[model samples]
Target: MLDAGIYEQLSRLVIAMKQKSSQNMAGNRRSVQKGTSAEFSDFREYMPGDDLRRLDWNVYARSERMYIREYFEEKEAVVSVILDTSASMHYGKKSKAELAQDLCAVIAFLTLHHMDRLVLYDSSQMGTPLVVSGGKNALPKVLGWLQARTFSGTETDSFSAVRQMQRRGAGVTVIVSDFLTEAATDPTQDCLEKTMQYLDFTKQRPVLLQTLCAEELRVTMDGTRNLIDMESKEKLRVTMRADVIARYEQELQKLSVRLKKSASAAGGTYILCDSEKERRALILEDLRPLFV
Candidate 1:
């Protein structure tokens, strides 16, 4: 969870950051102000002091009309934090589950602090998306809703929640998840492609955040054991050893690398978080720079 001190600093840092100039901004890209980017948002009748370079020469020549590009200021951004509550999320360390929840709390708190429209979505239960919208004052309510949630004890599609969500307008969509689901034959490619397409179609910027426990990075268990699937309750018997653990580590690294690359290819921010790190450290080192 976000502390009061860190909250204050993050609030100012994100809200006070200068808006991007529209004149040089690309079309369909996010900027500090809505419609301020030089990307043609709209056209208006030419007025005195209007930049001549912004005049639509083609329109004037074809229709004998005088018009200049008009850039409008973007209003308050809507920040939606999408969380995955899959059974796999519960499979990891207790700290991993707590950290995931903490991650959600921190991001939502920052979004609310910035005075943007903040909506929280969790897919632990399929079909029904728990959404709460409000300002910083509603932080308590959001946290309460999270506390009240009981995962269905079944698995779900994290991306399905994203597809069901309606974009109020173009804004930032942050996905917080373990990215492990039953639907993916290839978790990295399928999840990234589908998510990127959805965000692009909705005209919202994307931010992908993945949380993995230490066990996934480096195995600590040894000897013969029956590994139980937290969600499906299935069992797999295996003998743990140095070589097995090493191979697991190597595979996990490959998965992380692919997810990071996919995030970049989708034109968004990709961050891999260790569940063991302090929340404040994660915010300052990983999150603050992206917004500030």
Candidate 2:
């Protein structure tokens, strides 16, 4: 559950969604096509068919050159957030599912505030997505829709989540999940790579936000305990020795490296978040570059 103060805090920032929408409409995101925005993209030599209003009088007067002022085109884009609701997401006291709910809500608000179309997709079902538009006024309904989602599935359908989306123009497609899918056989491949490739094929810019529990990342168990797989309900009773803990940490680190490497190959951004920590910091600090 997000607090009112958090909302106010987020209001200071903006969501940097991928600007790939070919069909342009007025919005905050800078598009490839030139349009009216204060931020200047670059200057192009005046062409015969160029809009006369864009002609730079100062450049013409000073350099005797016909230069046209070009600014980044502001355009509306579809901001589809694919949230994983598998049982593994519910593994911690401050569960990934809980963090995902709040993350999606913030994303929805940012998208709507800037007049971008918003859709929240459930990766667990990989079916209908909740489409929303409007400004801050729509936050309540968006929050309600998000909180209403049930995390019941044993696993996530990452492929279906990306493959099933009806392409809503070139924009950012954010997939938020624990991404705890069993390691790929080759170790060189992961589910995220396949998902990002599908997004690339569909012309949507993909961004992956991988969430893990603090407990999982910083394992501290010291005694023998029954470790249960939330997804399979399979339990294994084993002693938590120093060597076992060391191996687990190594594996987690390897997974992190692989995920980052995969994201680079796919030309997508990979972000890791601890469910117990404040997500706003991640958004405002690490993700601000994309928004620009």
Clashes (backbone N, CA, C under 3 Å), per candidate, total 8, 2
Candidate 2 overall lDDT versus native: 0.73
- Once superposed on the true structure, which residue ranges of model 1 sit more than 4 Å away at CA? 15-74, 125-134, 182-189
Pairs of colliding residues, candidate 2? 16-291, 20-170
TM-score for candidate 2, residues paired by index: 0.79
| TM-score of each model, in listed order | 0.74, 0.79
Cα lDDT tens digits, model 1, 63-144, are 9989776556544556667777666776555455567777777777766665465667776543454444346787888778
lDDT of each: 0.65, 0.73
What is candidate 1's TM-score against the reference?
0.74
Colliding pairs, model 1 = 20-32, 22-36, 22-37, 22-38, 23-38, 33-74, 34-73, 34-74
lDDT of 2 by residue, 1-292 (tens): 7777767766766665444554234566556776665777667677433458878999999999997775667657778888888888888878888888877877787788777778788876566777776567877888888888888887775655677775666778888887777632236555656766767766676777788888898888899999888888999998999999998888778777876776666666778878878766765665664464
Model 2: which ten-residue window has the lowest total lDDT?
Answer: 16-25
Query: CA lDDT of 256 in candidate 1?
Result: 69
After superposing all C-alphas onto the true structure, candidate 2 shows an RMSD in angstroms of 10.2
